[model samples]
Target: MSEEPPYVVSPTADSSSTARPATFIFLHGYGDDAEGLPLGLAQQFQFNNKMQYLKWVLPNAPHNHEAMARAWYVPKALPNAVKPRVPGHEGEEDAPDDEVGIMQSVDMLDQLVEQEIKNGTPSERIVVGGFSQGCAVSLVWGLTGRLKHQVAGVLCLSGYMPLQTRIQQLRNERGIKDDDKDPKRWFYVHGTMDMLVPTRLFVQGKDELAKWVDKENIEEHLYQGMGHSTNSAELRDMLAFFEKVIPE
Candidate 1:
């Protein structure tokens, strides 16, 4: 195991604002780390004058292989199933399922969110999000009833839900029936052309999430001809979603 990954803070942060700033925590995609997402966002938004005070947190995944690529968890191949595609590589076989890894990331995230709550940020003012593998972990965090109130919103970009069976099992254990319509502050966006975590999985993720959250509360978007990545249009909508969910 490696040491904890470093985090990146956005320069757009308003230090002069007296009010407790709304916090957005982003988990990086596989093989990537903390600085990239915030840097990218900074490039676009540039902390525009109209935007409210905000704090962005981007955490890097621990280094994995010798090549220095970081993975949230090691993908495991299922019996007779095609190998899952490797990160940063296209046209690869299906990768294996790794619930253990997903949960481990969840545990780490739980601490991160809890720390924010302890540091004077309200649960409703915090938004958690990720891309690809990061997205999978964020979904797990949302599905967990214990952590449901810990965040105001979840942003999933070019990602899919993992450990579906375990989520249902836990829900059952908690006596949360399928029809319970809770707050659907989750915003999930995917590309229709995504072959890695196919569009089918994205749909399945939405359906499973619907069991807990009211359909009307959840926001879904699809990018036509887009691959396993995000686009400018999606980012714009995500900003809008945040403004509504977190507010100024």
Candidate 2:
């Protein structure tokens, strides 16, 4: 990551106004820097006037050298029994301590949201989302983090649910009440043909997640014929989801 890599914000409020009703914090996936998808989505949201009262924040992930390129975390080569038929590309650096790194990132995002609130945005109007690995991290944070600062919504794109045992620990550690209540604010999405994290894993993970919370709380959208990346339809659906969750 650049010492001062850009943290882009495209606000929808009038030029002279500093306050917005909502904020969307976007996280990018592995091997991808922060600029592309988040910026694109922000542009789309701006043009379509989706959630016109919301502002978009695209935060760059801490960089690591892997696959001769930058990556969010060091790629872990899967064990033979669990490896994908076609292995994904590997990058430099040791495997990430995902739980710790993600929590740290969440802390950073929380600070950003707090700053916005200081500038007049409400805590309830803040949303967090991400692509692929970014999606996984956001989901984990939303379900486990302190809810005194309740977020408006969360978007998980092309990602799988984290391991069940970890979620159990997170719930316990956070003292999150209503563990049985599903996370109604969550929007889960996955690509049917995602080779990186197979859709089957999501199905299995959902089943496990139900052991901890009501299945009704989480909404899922499985996009057919899509691989590891987001498509136009998914983008439209994401915009609609955000619009519905965060009022203009």
User: What are the TM-scores, per candidate, against the unseen true structure?
Assistant: 0.82, 0.79
Please give the distance, in angstroms, between residue 55's alpha carbon in candidate 1 and its true position after superposition: 0.7
Steric clash pairs (candidate 2)? 66-91, 66-92, 67-91
Candidate 2 regions exceeding 4 Å error are: 1-6, 13-20, 65-72, 78-97, 147-149, 178-184
Per-model C-alpha lDDT, please?
Answer: 0.72, 0.65
lDDT of 2 by residue, 1-248 (tens): 33544466656677676544677777887767667877777777678766666777777776554333444444354322133221344331234345655666656666666676786767777778888767766766676766423677778887655534577677777776653443336777788778777787667656664564456656678899998888888888877787666766
What's the CA error at residue 205 for candidate 1, in Å?
A: 1.1
The all-Cα superposition gives candidate 2 an RMSD in Å to the true structure of 4.5
Best by lDDT: 1
Count of clashes, each model: 8, 3
lDDT of 2: 0.65
